[model samples]
Target chain A: MTLPLLQVRDLKVHFQVRAGGIFFANYLPLKAVDGLSFDLAAGETLGIVGESGCGKSTLGRAILQLLPATSGSVAWLGKDLTALDRAELKAHRRHMQIVFQDPLASLDPRMTAGDIIAEPLRNYETGLSSAAIKARVREMMEQVGLLPSMVNRYPHEFSGGQCQRIGIARAMILKPKLVVCDEPVSALDVSIRAQVINLLMDFQRALNISMLFISHDLSVVRHISRRVMVLYLGKVMELADRDAIYGAPRHPYTQALISAVPIPDPEKERAKPRVLVAGDLPSPLDPPSGCVFRTRCPKATNICALTVPVLESAGVGHEVACHHWRD
Target chain B: MSASVLDLKNLSVRFATPEGEVAAVSELSLSVGKGECLGIVGESGSGKSQTFLAAMGLLARNGRAVGEAIFGGINLAAADENTLNRLRGNKLAMIFQDPMTSLTPHMKVGHQLTEVLVRHRNLKFPAARDRAIAMLRRVQISEPERRFEMYPHELSGGLRQRVMIAMALMCGPELIIADEPTTALDVTVQAQILDLIRRAKEELGTAVILITHDLGVVAGMADRVGVMYAGRIVELGEVHQIFNAPQHPYTKGLLACTPRLDDATASALVTIPGQPPDLQQLPTGCAYHPRCGNVMERCRAAAPPLMSTGGGGLKACFLENFGSVQAGTVVP
Candidate 1:
């Protein structure tokens, strides 16, 4: 069997946050990502979904090495990324790229669309001639539905949808093996979101690239990803195939999260039974013992507070970390 | 319908920007009934928010509103600042997207809620404080007595929104305009807040104008639905009619694009071809014709007015059968 394209094990990212003021300052470790493990095969999309402050974004950043992991290993193509030196990591960065949530903020304001798309190529592929880079930029622009005539236009001149198209062009210009899409369509208007989403899927099909899509929007994540992972308070609650997770989510938190999403059908939405989880997410600084989600979880028991549950396979391609999961 | 609480006629809002005058809202005529919820759904630059902003006299310095917004038998559109000041928070309340900015960070939440009652309802300090605590409890914020003394920063986002709702209800306004009230919240919290809004409507009988881009949100709450595009109401009908039999092509396109959680099919989402129109330089004819699926020659030559479609709804389209074909079924 070919080794999985990317493998992550026991990933943890902790930040030392300073608490209190002046003379009575104390340092507290905030575990942004605690013990997350997953594997992504080539041409697959793994979606990470959670509510605010649930550490989905932190996990994405750790995998990219944008932020240092306090422990655990991320192996890319048989090489452990955590142990890599600066020179080695720099060379490996060519195979990975990221697309941020805010398209306008992520792209450079001063740089024209042409130059923005060419910047990545110029950095990674120094051997390529300027003419070759320009040609590739033009081709990428066309692929993302941007006219070559608009290549010289600044981001400000383009609409939000156009700017996102430009952002996609830049991200795909390098032809990277993996791309981390961090809520790419969340900032866009409703009508324009589908356009950008389809553009991403089209690129995935053509390039056969792997993707780690991190989003709070459950519907979008389900639409794009093959597998979905649920996170709460820096811990994985459930991970399963897209259909299995959406159709038969095992963890209580996952069930509540999925049911809470408002469906478009009025008759169905009005009639559907909602599993409304009580209260907001507890602060990550003082997460509940055992199960991180027990504080707000509806099915909290003494055993849940005493003993932490570990991730175990319940079925084929379905894993959950809850002692009381029925399915 | 129940006695009209707020009636608007031919309302238009324009802003004098460097790129010339932008008509944000053009000739909008609508009314909200007592104890009814009117949802205005649109994408960015479709002028959903600007319509309510104009009605509230909250437009920017460069912005000007013309025409009439008849609230409680008074012409709010032509009302002076002094007249609007009396009715702004007392008779008509507005809830914004960000609760933190809408709230006063310096003042305790109890003081904030009591101040509205004292100013609008002319209640004594002690009585106002008691009523404010009751309002907080009504919004389901536990420990209202203790929470009353807490500042806005002390409460979580969901709690802050509850406080905002309490403040809005303090005056017992006849109409409440909530502009993306749950947009900043988590999904679970959003559900809670939306339930709170429904309770407010059911118990208090206060009319609501819910402005949001999420069709799912409108599906659950709205009684009457209005689809806006380029500062114009393209379709207006009952919520059920709008969802089940959307007449306008734009509305159909929007419904098609929104991925449904109930839908088990794994097909790619349907996308409208072009970007949302620029408010400054709208297309000559139909603002949506450029991106519309069933574009016709008449759609390019002339703008379609909001004509009664005989299907218990109004549709602005030149096509004979605008939404006869279901949208998003064929993803090209």
Candidate 2:
């Protein structure tokens, strides 16, 4: 097997809920991401599927070391990011970058689009002067389909889709080996979403970069990703190639997620019985005792609740955490 | 044949924007039966929402609407504010896509529901409160009694939408105009909401005109479907025919664009390849001609009238033989 470009093992992130000052000090932890493990091979796109509070975003942030991880390892290009100090981490930042969900929020209002993209290069590459940075910024802007003349425009002047292209240009300017795109296209219009997604795919092909693409949109993930991992309440439920995940989802939760995607065809929609799971997702801070999906799983037996099911190999390269795969 | 619950003939809606006078909906003709759901599907600026919004007499103050809106013998187009105000929440109720905007934030859910009952149904506070709780329960909202005191902020998006439905249906109106009711919801919850609407419409025997851009939602919810484009009803027919045998090029384009899970036999979706037309300057002939694959010289200059296509379908395309096909049956 080819060596993975990014390796993550036992990654955990917990927010400290400080309490009790008068009598006895007590600390409660909100385990947003706990013991999560995944890997992204060279030039491969790994899609993360989960709902809003499922810690998928937290895992992304933890991998990038944007948020401090409580424990575990994030090995990128033979370097363990967990042990890196502040200065060392800063030095290693150029190879890995992220694109946030809301493009408007990520960019600065005061800075022009050209300056925004150049800021990363300027801060990291101090040897390069202003003139060289401008040339590089112009090249990156055109690559992402933004007009070079509009480089002087601010974030507010551009539409949601354009702002996202600017965001992509900023992320890709560093020439990162791996990009963590967290719901980058969710905020865009449906028509514009396709354009941005196609652009990203094109850029990825040209750069030969690996991406940990985290999004709730299964269709978008299916279109671009090589592999997909299903997360539920801070735990992995299923992980497989994109085709298997979208085509033949093994886990019950994965099945539910895919089935829930609104198929635009009226006839096919009418033909299929919608497998809508009842109730909201279980809180990550206080997840269920055993299989995370047992609470909502239709075929869940008492065994599912009593014992946690580890990822068992279902077929070639398909792993699912369902307690009862057969009868 | 059954009398139409709501019918609009040659309906047109325009807004005076900073740019120009834009016709959001133009020459649109459609109807709803006594208990039927007519799903209007289209993209943004297709005027799907605006068409229904005009029919409900709920367009913003600046909007200009013309043509005929004959609803159970009353002409809504020429109706005064007092007439519209009287008929709005009681006679014709509309539920929007976003419940947060439709619902008042500071007010308790119960109080809002009760206000509708008290004002339209003419019930007193205690009786209204009792009915509101019953309405909440009817929509399958959990703990209706205690939930009554909670504000809009306290409820989830799905729950708040349920509350909105309860309020919309509280008056027990003849026509319930729901505009993209499930667009803001998750897929699983979207199915659940559709089920709720389906059940409530049946129980109450209310006619619904569900306007949505999601064809999947329309497929599950609608009895009949109307395809809109650039502010006009380009195609209208029974749901089965519209899905199985789409005739218009624009309609075919829409059908092809959808991504389905079970549909592994996927073809490259033929997207319309451009933004929805600028309503201010709608194309001379078919608004869809620019993006249409089967464009002809005749399609570029002459606007196709909304004429009936035989077998209970209506289409507006220069390419379709409308007059000879449906004979002489008018839409409404």
Candidate 3:
């Protein structure tokens, strides 16, 4: 079998947050990304979806080695990224890049559009002349639908959508094998969102770059992703092909999450049955004992709290972590 | 329609900015009937929120509102602070997008709820407290008694929103202007909040004006929707008509731009080229003419007025028979 482009095994990211008053402060381990395992093909999009505190962003950062993992490994083409030191990881940074959520905030106000996009090239290809780098930057700007003439304009001068194009141009300039998009279009207006998403899709198709697209917007995820993974309380609840996850989500949390998304068609939205899970997500500091989602899972029972449910195959290319998935 | 609870006639809101005079909302006219939800859908800077903010007498210091917002036989736009204050929390209430910011961080959540009743309804402290707790329970915040004493920060985002809803329902206001009430909430939590709003409308028969950028939210919650662009209501129609057959070019482009859950195909999303209009220096004639796919010479010279679509809705477009026109053929 051909090796997957990226392999993540039992990856975990835990933060030690200080709790209580200053005099009686104690550290609590916040399990942000807990034992997540997945694989990305050479040119495919794996969408990570969950609510605000579900740690989808943490998983994306952990896989990219931007955040330190507490345990397990992330292998890129058979090389373990977690095992690498700062110097070693620096060498591998050229292979991976991230597109952040807040486009304006992600970009430096002092940097011009051309310099921002050209920074990656300057860092990676030290031999390239300044003129050559400028040419490449302008070309990438044009490719991303930004006018090549606006290369010298500062980040603040551009609109939200244009700033995002600059950010995408920077990420794509490296020609990275994998791009991690963390809510890339959430900040954009509805009309502008489609534009940014299309740009990313176009880049992915042309360059054959693998993507770890993390977003809370299920509809956007469904549009761009080949496979979707549902996360709840820092654990994978269900992972399957986009069709299986959206069409026939087995996990109770997945079902509720999918049902909660309001369809644009008024008639269909009104007719659709909603499976709303009760209560908010439990604190990551002290998650539920066994299945993390058991506290809010509709199908949760005594057994769910007694024993942790491992990811089990339900069908071809579909895996769900639920005690009563079949039901 | 049922007895009009709030009728706005040519309401225009302008803000005095350092750059120049910014027209936030211009020549907008709409009404909300009893027990009806009139959704105002628009992107940021489209002036959906400002229209209601002006009616509520909540515009910023430099902002000025003209025209009439007739409610309870009073022109709210021209009403003084005393008249507006008396009506604001008693007959009218607002639930903002961010619960944390809208709520008083320093005060107990329960106190905030009771204060509304005590001040607006002339309910005494003990009676107001009882009503506040009951209101909390109605919004489905578990252990209402325990949650009452807690500050807004102690509660989760969903729970805080419930508290905000509970506060809004304290005096049972006739008209509740919910400005993106569930925008900051998670999808699952948003469902719960929206359900609460739906119940409030259905059970209490209170009129609601839901202002949001999300079409999906409007689809589920709103009975009638008004699609706004460049400080104007470009399309006003029943929810079914708006979504099923949008008449305005901007509204159509917006509906097409939104990624639907059911459409999982690999087709490229139809983008409305260019960005949202700048409020300060909006394009002359039709503000949307620059980005609109169906732009014509007439559209460039003269802005279209709100005209009847002959389908129980109004659309601001010069195009004749927009529904029958083919996609690419309209430009000529």
The numbered model that scores best in DockQ is 1
Candidate 3 residue lDDT tens string, A168-239: 999999899999999999999998999888889989999999999999999999999999999988899999
Q: Which runs of model 3 end up more than 4 angstroms from their true locations?
A: B324-332
For each candidate in turn, the TM-score is 0.98, 0.87, 0.98
Pairs with backbone N, CA or C atoms under 3 Å apart (clashes), candidate 2: none
> Tens digit of lDDT per residue, candidate 1, span A1-327?
999989999999999999777998888989999999999999999999999998899988898899999999999988999999999999999889888998889889999999999998988899999899888988888888889988889999988888888888888888889999999999998878988888898888889999999999998998999999999888999999999999999999989988889988889889989788888878778888988888888888898999999998979989999989973
Give model 3's docking category.
medium
Error of 3 at B11 (Å): 0.8
Where's the lowest-lDDT run of ten residues in candidate 2 chain A?
A188-197
lDDT on C-alpha atoms for all candidate structures: 0.89, 0.81, 0.91
Per-residue lDDT of candidate 2, residues A1-327 (tens digit): 767888999898888766567677777777788788877888899999887777899999999999988998999876899899999999889988899999899999999999999989988888998899999999999888788999899999887778999999999998888899999988765555656776777767788999999988777777778899988878889999988888888888888888777666666776777787876566555678878788888998888888999988988889988877755
Per-residue error at A70 for model 1, in Å? Answer: 0.6
Query: Local error of candidate 3 at B265, Å?
Result: 1.0
lDDT of 1: 0.89
List of chain B TM-scores, one per candidate:
0.97, 0.93, 0.97
DockQ of each candidate, alpha-carbon based: 0.75, 0.30, 0.73
Candidate scoring better on DockQ of 1 and 2: 1
Ranking by lDDT: 3, 1, 2
For candidate 1, the TM-score of chain A alone relative to the native chain A: 0.98
